[model samples]
Target: MHYSLPLALALGLLLVACQSAPSDTSTSAEAMADATPGAAYQLVWSDEFDGEHLDTTKWNYNVGGHGWGNNELQFYTDARPENARLAGGTLRITAIHEPWEGKEFTSARLTTKGKADWTYGRFEIRAKLPSGVGTWPAIWLLYTDKEYGNQGWPDNGEIDIMEEVGYDPDVIHSTIHDKAFNHSIGTQVGDTLRIPTARSAFHVYRTDWTPDSIISYIDDQRYFAFGNTGEGWEEWPFDHDHHLLLNVAVGGNWGGQQGVDTTAFPTAMEVDYVRVYQQK
Candidate 1:
C-alpha cells in the first residue's frame, strides 16, 4: 500500500524521533586506535554484526506492515536474508522504493527480541547513517511486555536512543514516551545532538538507563536526561525491561517530502556494533 505523502512524512519523523560526524583528518583504523575507551562496565550482550550474514540466532525480524504504530509503508519481513545482512564488520538494512507483497516499500526491521532484554544498563551502537531526502534510520528500544498492564502505548513506555532524519542531517534525537506525553501529539521530553558528518562516518549513540534516570549520550557526550518522577506510569514507564530495534525506512509519513530519490536506491544504514553493559 502506498502511504499518503503527509502520513509518510509524519511517520518518517516519528519513527526516527524514537531515536554524526566525520573528520577526514584520520582513517578509520587510526581513529579506532585513538578512540577513548568507553567507561568500564561489565559486558552483558553484544553483536558485532560481523561475518557475511546476519546471525539469526540473535535477532528476529518484525516483518510486514503491522502499521508500525506510525502508518509506516514498508512490510517488515523475518528471515528474509535480503532485509538483513552482515558485511564488512557492519550490519546493513536497506530501504528500497519498490513493490513487495502488496506494499510499495520494502525494508527490514531487526530486533533483539527473545534473545536479550535489559532493565537498567548502558547501551551503545556505532553506526553510519544512509543519506537521501526520503531515508529514515533509527536505533531505539521498546518494552518487551505485550502491554503495559492495559495502560497501552506510551503508557507502556518507549525509549529512542537515536533517531535521525535525512533532511536534518546534523541533528540526532533521543526521547522517551509515556502516557502523559507522546511524540504523536508532540509532547515528549528529548534532546538533539549535532553531528557534522553523521552520514559519512561512524559515531556512537548511547544511553545509560538506571533506576533513577535515563541519560542519552552521543560519543560519550551526554545531551539528554529524564528522571523518574513520583507520578508513576504517566510520567515514567521505563522501570521494566526492553529490547533493541534497528531499521531503515523510506518514504513514510516523514520521509517522502522531496519524494523518493530513486537514484539513491539501495541506501544503507550501517551499524558497526551494538553492545550492552551492566553495572557490576
Candidate 2:
C-alpha cells in the first residue's frame, strides 16, 4: 500500500527477482579485488566538471516534471543550460525533445543532496551513455535526510551506482533498495553488466561503500554485491549519510518499457568525473 517517495522510487525500478543466486560474478570479482581501497582510499570528494559552469558549490538542481516517480518524461530543469552543462571537461546530462512546463522532454537532475554527504565511501563516476531507445541513465545513492520509513524511499536506502537502458544497450545496472529488499517485494538486491563499449566509451562507474558491504563496479569489474544483513533497517540500510544522483531519464517505468525513441532526441549523459573516496 504505502508508496510515495516518488512512488517508492517508481516502484524501485522493478527487475522482478525472487532472489538468492549471486556469488560467482567471478566470485564477486574476487571479493571485490580483496576489499578495494588500496592505499586506504582518500580523495574525499570531487567533481572535475572542470569549470565552465555547473559547480553550484557541487550541484543540487533536482527541479521537476512530476513523473520522477518514473512515469517519467523529463522536465527537470533549473534555469536550463540545454538541460545542464559544462563542456569539454564533461557533465552533460542533456535529454531534450522540446516543450517544457507541459513536458515533452528536457533533462538534468544533478544532486548531492546538501552538497556532498557520505558515510562509507568510494563512489566514482566517469561516464558516457545515452543511446537510442528512451534513455534512462543514472548513478545513484540516497538517504541524505529522511532518515527512514514512509518517504525515505524504500525505507532509508538505495544505491544503484549506475543504471542504463537506452533499450538495454550495454546492460549495466547495480542495485540495492531496502525496506526488506525492494523492487516492491520481489526481494531485490541487484547486479548486471554487459559493457561492450557501454554506449560508445568512457567507463568507471563504481561504488564500494563499506561498513559491511555494497560493492558494484564496471571498470574495476566487481559485478555487484549487497551484504550487511544483521537483520535490521529492513535488510540493512547502509547506515547514515548518503547523497549523489545525476540523471537523464525520459520515458519511465523502466525507461518507457520499450517505447519512446523520438529520434533519441538530443540525448546525453556524459559526466567525465565525480569521485569521492574515504577510509583515510
Candidate 3:
C-alpha cells in the first residue's frame, strides 16, 4: 500500500511499462453476482471503474499533509492518474515509498467527498486487499465537518467499517470510536472476523448503517454491530451524514510494525466496485 523512494521509482517505471499492456475489458452488471454466488441486493450507485482512467466525477483524492488521526506517510492527490487508475475493470490505488512534498510515500486516497454523502444506508465494496508487511487498507466513513465538541478525535466519532493490516491476512476489524473509546488507549470496542482468503480473493465488505445501529458484514455474514444508546457523543456522533474513504496506507505507526517489504513495492488495493443501497 505504501512504499519508499527507490520502490516508488521502480513502481512508476513499472506502471509506465504496464500502461501499454493489454488487459481484460469485459464487464457486465453481473460481476458481483458471479463473485458472490446468490447474494440478493439492489444497486443504487455503482462504479466498476471500467474505463482506462479514473472517473473524476465519482471520486476525488485527498491530497497533501499527514492525516490528523494517524501519522501516515502518504499524500493523497487529486486527478492524478498515477495515484489511481482503471485497469481490467478494477480501480487500482497503489502505494509507493517515494518522496513527494517531503513525505516518503505517495499513494492514492480516493473518496466520494463532494459527490456522495449518506446518513444511513447499506454500503458495499468488492475488493482484494494489498498484501505484504506495512500495508494498511481501510474502508471507513467520516463526518462532513470538523466540529468535535470540547475534545477533538473521538468526540466527533469515527466508524471504521473495515480495517485490515497486511501482517494479519486472515483477520478483519470493525470498530466505532467516540469520546469514551478509541484504538489509541486500547479502550476501543469492536469485533474481528477471520477471513483466510481475504487477500487472495475479492470479497464484499459491507456496512448497514441505520438510525438505531450500525452493522458490519463480510461477504453475507454479519460480524459486528454498534447501537445508538441515546446517551451522548460517547455513544453516537453518527447521526449526521458522512462520506466514504477508501485508501491503502503504508508505514504508519500501526502499519509499519514489522517494517516494509521491498519486494511488495507497488502493492495495490483493487476495488472491483462500490455500491450504495437505500431502503425502498
Which ranking of candidates, highest TM-score first?
A: 1, 3, 2
Which consecutive 10 residues in model 3 have the weakest lDDT in total?
Answer: 21-30
Q: lDDT score of model 3?
A: 0.70
Which candidate, 1 or 2, has the higher lDDT? 2
Error of 2 at 214 (Å): 5.1
| TM-score (all chains, Cα) for each model | 0.82, 0.33, 0.80
Off by over 4 Å in 1: 1-40, 146-151, 184-186
After superposition, the stretches of candidate 3 with alpha carbons farther than 4 Å from their true spots are 1-42, 146-152, 184-186
User: Best-fitting candidate, measured by TM-score?
Assistant: 1
List per-prediction Cα lDDT, in the order shown. 0.72, 0.77, 0.70
Model 2 steric clash pairs: none
lDDT of 2 at 120: 79
Best by lDDT: 2
RMSD of each: 8.7, 16.1, 12.9
Per-residue error for 121 in candidate 3, Å, reads 0.4
**Model 1 Cα lDDT, one tens digit per residue, 1-280:** 1122243344455444334111221232233323323435799999998788788788888877755655566777666666677878898888776788888777898888788988888899999998877777889888886456555566677888988767666578777777655545544556678899888999999988776667788888777766665456666678887889998877666565556676776778889999999877
